[model samples]
Each structure stands twice: as C-alpha cells, then as structure tokens.
Target: MSNEAMQVRALRGRVVTPDHIIDDGAVVLSGSHIAWVGTADQAARAGFGDAVEQAQTAPEGGYLLPGLVDVHCHGGGGESFPNAETAEQAMVSVLEHRRFGTTSLVASCVTAAPDVLRARTRVLAGLCEDGELAGIHFEGPFVSVERCGAQDPTYIIDPDAALTRELIELGGGHVVTMTIAPEKPGITGDDGVNAALIEGGALPSFGHT
Candidate 1:
C-alpha cells in the first residue's frame, strides 16, 4: 500500500448502524473514506490492527454515527433561507447546521411570490453549486390553505406546471423537491406539477395536507 493509504486512523466507540449498534466497535478511516467498520476485535482480524491500536477512544458510553441529512430546513443561526437575499446569508444557516454534524442540508423556501421564490432559488442554487448545500426544497405556493400551517396563505396558488418548470430551471438543476398538496389541481397526470418535477430531475414532497 502507498504510504498515504497506510496512514489509517480509527475511532473506538459505540458504533450505530441501520440494523443495530455495536457497544465495542472500531471504525477505521483511510484518508477521507471509511476503510472498515466492525467490532474492535474484528478490526484487528481485518488487518487494521495498527489503526485500532492508535484509535482515538470516544467518550464513555458515547455513540458514533454517520453525518445527518436534513432535507427540510428553512434556516438556523438567526438566518432564514426563505429570506436570504445573498449567498453569504444563506451560508450562515448551512454552516450552523454543519457545525452540529448535519453535513448535508436542503435549503427550504416558504410560500412566497414568484419573484421572491426566484430570487431565493438563485441564491440557494449558487450555494448548491459551490457544494455548500445538498439541494433546494420549495415548501409552498401550491398547497392547501387549511393545512398551510407555517406557509404564507396569501402567496398560495393553484398548482401550475409551467411555473414549477420555471422554478426548476432557475434552480440550475439543484432543485431536489417541492412540497405540494396532493389534493391540489395540476398535481398529477402527464402535464402536471408532479410530472414537471419528475421530468426536471426533482420530486414532489406531499405537504400542507
């Protein structure tokens, strides 16, 4: 192995996985990727004995897990994605979440006028392009008023496939999902909002139900 690849590191802790948790586990990391994950003993058997020997032990009873993915976050650190007019402003929320282990986050926009939505999309899309944001999520503008909850009712409108397409284009392919009411018109069929989203490489998130 190259000297760089041989420079492996390990972390010993209660490793949490999808199926179960290992109380005495070790995670071997080679550079930026995880090289191995198993019980401490298994790590040694897997030829990671040196890594395990030099592993940094976690806090007593502490758990080690993967970074979180937050798909519906509006803002943090006193910054709201929906109101951010500049990329710097939106980055505040992104960095705040990243500081807490949320490595991937989707910036969500609330119900707003078409112009406002477009502006926010431009700002957020830039961050996505720069690898700061996972994607963009529009929370409203095509949802039911009765269940709008935090969405602004005044800007709510009937589902418009054309508008959806326009927003997706403005997102520069970084649009991940848009929250839409399933009961709304123009939400299904071939030329509907759902179809537009899917065609444009995005998804419809049923919300404000």
Candidate 2:
C-alpha cells in the first residue's frame, strides 16, 4: 500500500510569488518549494482547512519575498573579491552581501594579471562549492579600456580563448558568468573566446564597452 502523502503547511503573510503579489494571503509550502499560493479564505474553500494547521503568519506590515540575487557585486564589508587575501576574507564579503538581503551572489573580480585572476577565481570557486556563493564573475581583461570604470585599465587585455579556458578550468566548473566587450581585442565576429565560455557552461555577458 502507498504511504500517506506529506501534509502541506501554510505561511500567512504578504505572499509575493513570481507572477503576482497576494496581500493578506497565505503561501503553501511543501517541503522546500512553494506548493500553492492564494488567500487564506481561498485555501479554506479548496478544502485546505487542516492544511493551515501549524502554519506561520507574518508580522503586521511585513512582507515575504523570494531571496534576492546579485550578479555584479564586487565587494562589501571592507572586503574585495578581487583583492581577497584569503578565503576567509572572501567569505566576509559574502556575509556582507547577505546581510543586505542578497540570498544569491556571484563574486566579481576586477582586471588583473592572469595569475592573479586565476587565484581569485579558485578561491571564489571554493566558496561556490561550499554552497556559500552562487559562482564567480570575471568582469575584466576582456572589456574595453575606455569604458573601464573602476577596473584597472592597466591590467586590461584582449580576449584570449585559451586564457579564458584556463580561468574556467581553474574554477573547476564554477564560473557562472564573465563580462566581455565583444569589440575588445582578439574578439572578432564569432570569437573563439565566446565559444569557450559557452562550451564550459558559463554565460558571456556584454559590458564595459
């Protein structure tokens, strides 16, 4: 015989789902995911009176929102990802972002030497593997020097597919995204660098150009 299905629980608050917001509504949570979302009255009408058992309610004037994701944050709390002296320092930065309500974050590194970039990527990759970070974001070297805002223009270089692969490989498949100027040196139409990023399951974003 089949076992009893797990009971659904409700969280009463301002439920903000992907599509819409439900004020004074309830969110049904099944295990780790959102199972259902609607007004409390609607749930009761749908035969979920018992489902509201042991549910939580939000404080007055409070809202429940999905965890925020930041893709291009460089540093916070007196720590810089590109200048991270150690993994511990890097973690401090992550904590800072989290405190500001960033549930998911990618550690972005600025323009630097290949060796420096590789080292930083490896450190950030470890954080990703540990589930503390989303992934690493390389935001320089392949960007335009003229458009380089805070990045060190001296460290900027043309896009090199092999070098890109080196960084990606060093990250052990944790490179989530990299900003590239399609007009940067070594990046022609159908540049191999873009191909390498795509092949390694990393997104090639356009910026700084």
- The C-alpha lDDT values of all candidates are 0.93, 0.84
Residue-level error in angstroms, candidate 1, position 77:
1.9
Error of 2 at 98 (Å): 2.7
Clashing residue pairs for model 1: none
For residues 1-209, could you state the per-residue lDDT of candidate 1 as single tens digits? 77777678999999998899999999999977899999998876799998898999988988889989998999999999999999989999998999888999999999999999999999999999999999999998999999999888999999999999999999999999999998887898899999999999998889898
- Predicted candidate 2 versus true structure: per-residue lDDT over 111-133, tens digit per residue: 89998998898888888899988
Give the C-alpha miss distance for residue 4 in model 2, angstroms. Answer: 15
TM-score of 1: 0.86
Error of 2 at 65 (Å): 1.9
